[model samples]
Target: MAKKLWVERNEDGSWDAYSDDGAHIKFGHGKGLFNPGDLMKVALAGCAALSSQFPIENALGEGKGARITVDGDYDEATDGYTAFREQVVVDAQSAGIHGDDAEKLKDRVERHIEKSCTVKHTYEVATPVTMKVKVITK
Candidate 1:
């Protein structure tokens, strides 16, 4: 389903990609672009954040503030990533999603993000990919 995502690197040494659904993302080592490792975080964390949107809203109602953070310690030599640590910080006191209700809502929100976020699920079950390198000699 994600094969539609395409990548391009410019002469300026910046990377850019297009998502299957038409999102344009830029990557680089400097400025506002996302570096390679940060991109991984963005993919997983962004998916989680987006996936949690509905649940957060449902629990706290519309227009409430909820922050989701996801981090993975990646080892490049092995291309292996450690378990992701996630934190969902909700402004319970201000938003009214406090006490027992907030705790249950937070638990449900985490579960929903883990279950429904595609990127997170994919990483949970790693897969082997077959690749072919093509050298174009035009």
Candidate 2:
């Protein structure tokens, strides 16, 4: 299994994520004000991007690469959100392969990533959540 990564929040509302291999990355409020949920999207995009290259190369041969861009539309109320939409463009090609083939390859790659990515998997499972809030009068 691949090694795990960890992230910790400091007292000042900043965070540092570290890989098991000893790499550290800073994230949070001033350095980009995003939560763990937002970072999951980035992770999904990155996983999809890397996974896409394999099949394109298999069908089109080596020296071909693909660029994948992912987006999503979410409504906070329903949570029946479209998690990701990927736009993939192939930069190199082998004989007899055209844009249509590239698109199909993109679809295949997308499906593979959806099935394999950890963040995407998290979205597929509905976790039980409870919320409580307190109000104070000044």
Candidate 3:
């Protein structure tokens, strides 16, 4: 299923991004909005969590999820991020997974995330993006 997404500039000078499924996010250079870089970080973190969700829940019982945090340093000269660090935190001890079992689970989850996260893979491959501009006349 191909999903459509778009962004619109608001009257207040901020931008609103929307998906066909009714998802909306306030973005751009604003006080409480997410910038482009923030969105990229969030996408990577979300992809990691989702990729590992099934394995994590299976090992730690249903509803047990992992928290993923993604951070990076942006270089002004290049206008891009230098590196991103993603940390996935799962409390195996609380779920009765310990010692060797915990280590095994950790390794399994990492492998799953590494194999399944498309967003991370895209970033790793540095996917090419093309932009087009249209002019409207009255």
Candidate 4:
């Protein structure tokens, strides 16, 4: 199924983004709202976490999960992000998987995320974005 997503500006100048599934997020250049860059980082982190969920749960149990953090470095000269670092932390040792087992689990999770995370794959490929503008006149 094709997904539809859009953002509408509010009277207060902030924007509300909505998806076809009813997911909503408030974002703009305002306090207590996520900026565009922050959303991108969040998307990457969420995708990675989801992509590795099955491997992590299979190794550590059903309720076990990983914490994924994505940080992007903004370059003022280019007015864009220069790099993004993602960290996925899973406490396999606490689940009794130790030493070589933990390392193997980590490697497996990384490989799974690298292969399955759509957002991460997009970032690596540098997808091109095209915009179309509509002008309305009274």
As a whole number from 0 to 100, the lDDT of residue 62 in candidate 3 is: 92
Model 2 alpha-carbon miss at residue 128, Å: 5.4
Ranking by lDDT: 4, 3, 1, 2
CA shift of 119, model 2, Å: 2.9
- Which runs of model 3 end up more than 4 angstroms from their true locations? none
Give the TM-scores of the predictions, in the order they appear.
0.83, 0.58, 0.93, 0.92
Using alpha carbons, what is the TM-score of model 2? 0.58
Worst 10 residues of 2 by lDDT: 86-95
Winner on TM-score between 2 and 4 is 4
Assess candidate 3 and give its lDDT.
0.91
| Residue range 23-89, candidate 4, lDDT tens digits | 9999998789889999999999999888999999999889789998889899999999988999999
lDDT by residue (tens digit), candidate 3, 32-85:
988999999999999988889988999998988898899999999999998899
Q: What is candidate 1's CA lDDT for residue 107?
A: 86
Local lDDT at 117 for model 1:
88
Worst 10 residues of 1 by lDDT: 88-97
Over 4 Å off, model 4: none
Task: Count clashes in each candidate, considering only residues at least 3 apart in sequence or on different chains.
Answer: 0, 0, 0, 0
Error of 3 at 123 (Å): 0.5
